[model samples]
Target: MTVPVRPDARRNATPYLYGREAAAVARVLESGQYGHSDVTEQFERRVANWLGVPEAVSVSSGTAALHAAFLAAGVGPGDEVVVPSMTFCATIQAILATGATPRFVDIDPDTLCVTGDLLMEAVTDATAAVAPVLFGGRAVDLSSVQGEFDRRGIVVVEDAAHAFGSRDGSRPVGAGGTALTCFSFGPIKNLTCGQGGMVIPRSPQEAERLRRLRLLGVVQSQNERADITTYHVDSFGLRYQLSSINAAIGLAQLDRFATTERVRRRLWRAYRQALAQVDGVTLVDVDVDRAVPHLCQVRVPRRDEVFAELRARGIGVGVHYPPNHRQPAFAAWRRSLPATERAGAEILSLPFHQHLTRDDIDHVASELERALKTTGGS
Candidate 1:
């Protein structure tokens, strides 16, 4: 099959198994119960076990996971959450959804995550939480910020959408932190469920609250509530529960996650080896042995030109994000995020997926090298 020039626009995951996924959907259709049910609950338990968390609340999307994490962590109106300006717009949107302000922080140039210094600088009297996203599956030094936040009594919510199966100092992404870590199961993620996400709470109480909040504040119970016949609203909530069908897909994906991760690591290594000799290109910082990279991003001077050149040469390249602060919606909160702004201009994500072959990696590297050469790279 001829691969599309742009990776993002192409079907990279399990192209041969489209029929099987269709069959799964068909099975769900035959079942007739489409919304939250036993399948969703099973998937939640499975994911919780996978993350080694007490509970995992499946949600409609990764954005929902963020919103739920913020709410469950007691973030509210007039509060501020420190977030890296270098992330996707959805991160900001989730903060805004909670009636909280997102205080944009600069990133560490090497790791592409919120730096300890920048995070400390962004903290203020109104700061309620600090959300550090693990960019491109690399483990960030959040320990320092965690210490600072602990001293100040601030909540930490990890945006681990890119770091599933990743470890920080021998602990899993969601483990050993007071933060509520969220994972994405979007189609393009390391483990996809068509469209879904999960929040791994820091405590059982928090996890219970998340579960309740996800399902419109309906607390789970074996016996029906005495006031089940009456209307009661103890707190605000949302309709963010994941569908059973999506959960089923997530379970299937989880079963294959280990094998997929191995393939992805090999592919990433091959790319790194092939592109290592190229000048004016620096790979993102990642502890290869511990990190199960979700994407391969590089810092290149002429990112746009190289991206366009790669596309023209039948290679797919993607931009992880444009600075969230630069976006019109968050412009009012925008400040001088030098590292984030610079990285936004320099970062380019190369094609990466479990399905990509060594030949594909070679093609991508060769095309990237040519693109850089043509764009006047030294």
Candidate 2:
């Protein structure tokens, strides 16, 4: 007897490459201009336009973008940056990288984002910034919280790794925020550039500072001559510049973003409609009109057992993240985060992407229903 292999639930065809991404890479390769070049500039312009911001700086990774944002925002040692405990470790690590403490805050179980009430409680005299993470492509309403932070002179940085196309009201995620906003273009993100990130500054001054910081604090002189170098290092900086090759890919990804987002929303609705009646499972509340739906996540009982059952049936499932405070590195910050802990244990990410079909969703729903039944949920 032979064991049967289930179809891969994670299968995606061609990976949604940008139309000109390959050409851009090939152009760079042929020109031998691998470092930051005109292509990078073009990519920045495109991203800025897309977000309706004045400036955008491409970086090596999303974490790098966050670190740079912290520095640009003047968050330093001994300062505390309020962050959600339910977010990925990168958000906390970025604060640590800036020599700042990550003060963990609880999340809203309905929205899966840091609640304003919880954030207010966490704010202290030592607090320098608040990073409102947009989880699973859900738009976080930072407008009201922005006023609170502004009154206290606290900066608000958006951890929009999963929110490339997320919008609040009529504005995009990166726009209309007084604080710095960071976006990820990682392979798994809504937008893919293999591995890249960007920082959208609130002003031109911030943008200039970020550009210098990205390239080792080196500012170019007007002469454009290497012999007459002006080695002015205003502040500590890091090498977080994105390559032209990656920018080309990013540009391509941007072109197809609108289509991909549409597909994602459709899939999310399909899941909600199909699994609405499933016992012990509740879909996250999201504003489909503004959100792009990065991942279709839900709170379910017996999450581990359900995850295992899905895997056994050739369905690929995922957890958005574990509580960041619970990580060993942040043990000192690990206090009781009831909502985060509960979400960690009960949340399950169903297979959702541009490639998933209606049939695929049906199969997932069937497997999930069976899993719930197996766990004694009538």
Candidate 3:
């Protein structure tokens, strides 16, 4: 039997839970070890195995993941990181946390991702790294220019926060072992650990460095520390370890990710088909065949008015982000990004979650069509 849509299409996004999530959390609570424990390590191991990688380092949040990655890659004061101005503010904030200056660049309006040419053009002698955000779960390929980046000693730290199960080609997003890829299991991501993130390191040494960084520079394991009089502080770090409680939620979610992938892809395709009938809307291409889509975004004329109209009609609509270059906080790093600014003004995210039914999608599309007409955008 088909399940009815939950509530109205008023939530732009929400965490979709499997039946096992509660029991998994309860199991962790009953174990008494709430901090980084066996469960947390197990979650790490499972994530590594799922990605077909040697190891995965768990951290507190996606921001922490990026910060640790930059620190581990030796991105520090005076070093510049090239990034897209169209991404969420968190991406830029993480770069600042590393004491690196952001050299903001533009994105392809179609994919909302930085191209190899854009990244290469932005790189200079002081460029320490380039962070390509896999916006809306579409992978950004830098293979054509990867050798040049390596020659220049520029690390590739991918913000795969929106792309957990996505593919760069045939392999999974992080499975290629080239870039230091970060994944977020935040509340509304493809997978939810309640709030957690993982970093797939390029090497074992890098993986070890990440572990120490997340654990406040502690060299000893939780069990090892328990038996020791004092543990050594190896270097600078943060209290960014993923907790056992959150890891439990992640393990439960990971077990059922196949279903999650299927449902997300199906819903995204449904939106594409439905939105095809709606005029004056361009659905952002997520390459649904290879991506487990994280958002259903569309560009529209008269976006603000159309957004207001949709909200008034009880349909959820939102903007993914405003360009960070235009924000007061990052104004010093600002550059003229015509494409990003134009996209920022037009982009609107529609209601997208596993809770949505086909009827709900149709309702949103129908409302959007009416809104465009009312706003004189159609």
Candidate 4:
């Protein structure tokens, strides 16, 4: 797991920077407002309006966003949160941070999302919430399970880290009124704010609580940066406030959506066309025109072999996940997830970013065929 630092072999495997990102940082630096300030509030308002949400609470990271949402939802010791095993470990860790149990659930194999049926079967009297992820930026089909979640009174905390710009028909992913929806602005995510996240809260009350939780539970306003002598602490909180500098970069990235999304769409379409009937390889319906993808992954029979082959040939391939249930640290939370286990073994994420050229797409596709041949895959 320890990859030696190889500065010389740097690969642009994630969403690369647009020209204005540095300027954004510089503006924040020169303003001398490094702490959480008006710029942070401005970014939150823009994000909330963009998502059509009443309140958007900006935080330190996507994991922190998830943690804050869980706490706001009252998920604590002894409560169970049903989550898909086919997701990042952050989902499990976020729940654990609240002293709650994470119940691993299998995906629907086809959509690679936890279906309403699977979710229904996983819950119990102790179930407090279900955090469904928009995996690889694929929109989760919530239609089937929305009724059940309402009837059961289970809070839906959508993990929309990958679904930042994705839309459902005409509605944006985070705009829906869920208990909470989290977005990431990590270095590798579609939108980068150095390292930050934003949570679209269901109510103004929850929004206020999240703001308090992010700054050591000290209930204070942004204007209090000038007069911090007076404040009140209600309960436990953490130092999870996103700096103004980070928020500036995020604001800049939001402005670049028009150009950045186009590059992603073009390259993603190129990959889709090039790999169209490769024998043993299967791709999810990325619908790049509609969804802004964070990764372009495929399911290949000899995935490990293919993963190694591509990387050996200077192609930066990756694995989106190794099922949460299979992790030794989360052994106590283990449960049988056949589809998740099988998919984890076969999933392969190819190098995807605005930096990739059409030639790069062809090369990756051609090399995939070569790898499949050597591994005895059709």
**Model 2, range 133-231, lDDT digits (tens) per residue?**
989887777666778888888988889998889887888888875768899988878898878999999888999889888988877622243567456
Candidate 3's C-alpha lDDT?
A: 0.93
Candidate 1 per-residue lDDT over residues 32-57, each given as its tens digit: 97988778888988877877777777
TM-score of 3: 0.98
Model 4: lDDT of residue 253: 90
lDDT of predicted model 2: 0.83
For candidate 3, give the lDDT of residue 41: 95
Clashes (N, CA, C under 3 Å) per candidate = 1, 0, 0, 0
**lDDT tens readout by residue for model 4, 144-232:** 77887888888988888887888866788887775588999998888889899989888889988898889898877768745776788
Cα error, candidate 3, residue 117 (Å): 0.8
Which structure among the candidates has the greatest TM-score?
A: 3
Q: Give the TM-score of candidate 4.
A: 0.94
Model 1's alpha-carbon lDDT is 0.81
What TM-score, computed on C-alpha atoms, does each candidate reach? 0.92, 0.94, 0.98, 0.94
The residue-level lDDT of candidate 2 at 169 comes to: 80
Number of the top-ranking candidate, with lDDT as the measure: 3
lDDT of each prediction vs. the true structure?
0.81, 0.83, 0.93, 0.84
